[model samples]
Target: MGRGDKKSKKGKITKGSYGNARNRKAIKAKLKRTASKKTAAPADGATKQKRTIKKKAEA
Candidate 1:
């Protein structure tokens, strides 16, 4: 019939209730893991040294 009836048929509660703290924490942890993977920096330390040497040569 309506949206509520459809959800009930699927055995899902489409209402916003409290006590979702665990769900929120799990979502935040997942986001942090994904963000860390995307922003990973290079491990080699030579690039920084090369930049400094080039700057000194120019001066």
Candidate 2:
């Protein structure tokens, strides 16, 4: 039987009581690191333009 303090089959914490708190720490660290990264913006003269979605046709 799987224990509550270890990772479950799908790699999630089995209990909500800080049993196996490693998952929480790892996820938080990952989020912090990812949030620190700065994404590059499109160049002013690039071919990219604002996108628009097509309207749905009347049934």
Candidate 3:
């Protein structure tokens, strides 16, 4: 059978598979960790300055 004609016994939809509950939870947890890392404190003045600039632009 061709790829498009094949069926998954697990009932998964290939496109936008993150709609699956397990996948969605995993993705959300990963994003939370990434966002925390990004917003973590800067070690030096230059990085803090850049962050202030970004916040101002966002505001």
Judged by lDDT, which candidate is best? 2
- Displacement of the residue 42 alpha carbon in candidate 3, Å: 3.5
lDDT of 2 by residue, 1-59 (tens): 36533455333344443335445677788988787653544568465578999999999
lDDT per residue (tens digit) for residues 1-59 in model 1: 33354334222234432134225466679999999986887787434454444445665
TM-score of 1: 0.36
Instruction: Return the lDDT, model 1, position 9.
Output: 25
lDDT of 3 by residue, 1-59 (tens): 22232243233334334444336678789999999998887677465334444445665
**Distance from true location, Cα of 28 in model 2, Å:** 0.1
TM-score of 2: 0.33
lDDT for 3 in candidate 1 is: 37
Better of 1 and 2 by lDDT: 2
Clashes of each: 0, 0, 0
lDDT of 2 at 52: 100
- Candidate 3: give the clashing pairs: none
- Give the alpha-carbon lDDT of every model: 0.52, 0.57, 0.55
What overall lDDT, based on C-alpha atoms, would model 2 receive against the true structure?
Answer: 0.57
Q: Could you tell me the lDDT of residue 2 within candidate 3?
A: 28
The runs of at least 3 residues in candidate 1 whose Cα sits more than 4 Å from the true structure, single-residue gaps closed, are 1-22, 42-59
